[model samples]
Target: MNAHPQPAEDGANAEHATPSGPPPARLLRLPEVINRVGLRRSAIYQRMSEGRFPKSRSLGPKCTVWVEEEIDAWIRGIADRGG
Candidate 1:
C-alpha cells in the first residue's frame, strides 16, 4: 500500500456511504399524495390552483411529485387547526 492514501474515485468509501448531512427530502407521486392527504386527484389539483395545497414539482413533461416533508407538514397544520 502507498504511504499516502488516495481518495476513492468511485465514491465507495465508508464516509461517503453514510452521509452526515440532513436526510434527503423524499418525493411523493400524485397517487401516494392523494392517498395520504385523503383527497381525490381533482380535489388535489383544485386545492393547488387555489393555493391551499402544496404545489407539486414537475419532474418532466408528464411527471410530477411533491416533497413528502411539505405534505406531512400540511397534514400536521390541518390537525393543529382541527380541520
Candidate 2:
C-alpha cells in the first residue's frame, strides 16, 4: 500500500461533486429571515399576509422557511423601488 495515497485525478470524484449550474436553494428560518430583512416576526408575518413578502414553506407543523433567493430578490426590489 502506498504510504501516502495521492488525491483522486480530476473528474475522478465528479459523481460526488455537485453539478455545475445554479447553486442549491437555501432555506432561511424565521429568525434568520428577520435578521436578513430587518423585520420583526410580526411584521414579517404581516407582510406575508398582505402578499408583500416572500411566502414561506412549512417544513412541519411548526417549522417554516423562506427561500434565500426570494428574500434577496424582495430586498433588491425594495432598493430598486427607492425604498
Top candidate, metric lDDT: 1
- Candidate 2 C-alpha lDDT tens digits along 1-83: 75644544674554465566999999999999988999899999999999999999999999999999999999999999999
1-83 in candidate 1: lDDT tens per residue? 76654556765654456676989999999999988999999999999999999999999999999999999999999999999
RMSD of 2: 3.7
- Cα-based TM-score, every candidate: 0.77, 0.78
Worst 10 residues of 2 by lDDT: 5-14
Clashes of each: 0, 0
Stretches of candidate 2 above 4 Å error? 1-18
Clashing pairs in 1: none
Query: Which pairs clash inside model 2?
Result: none
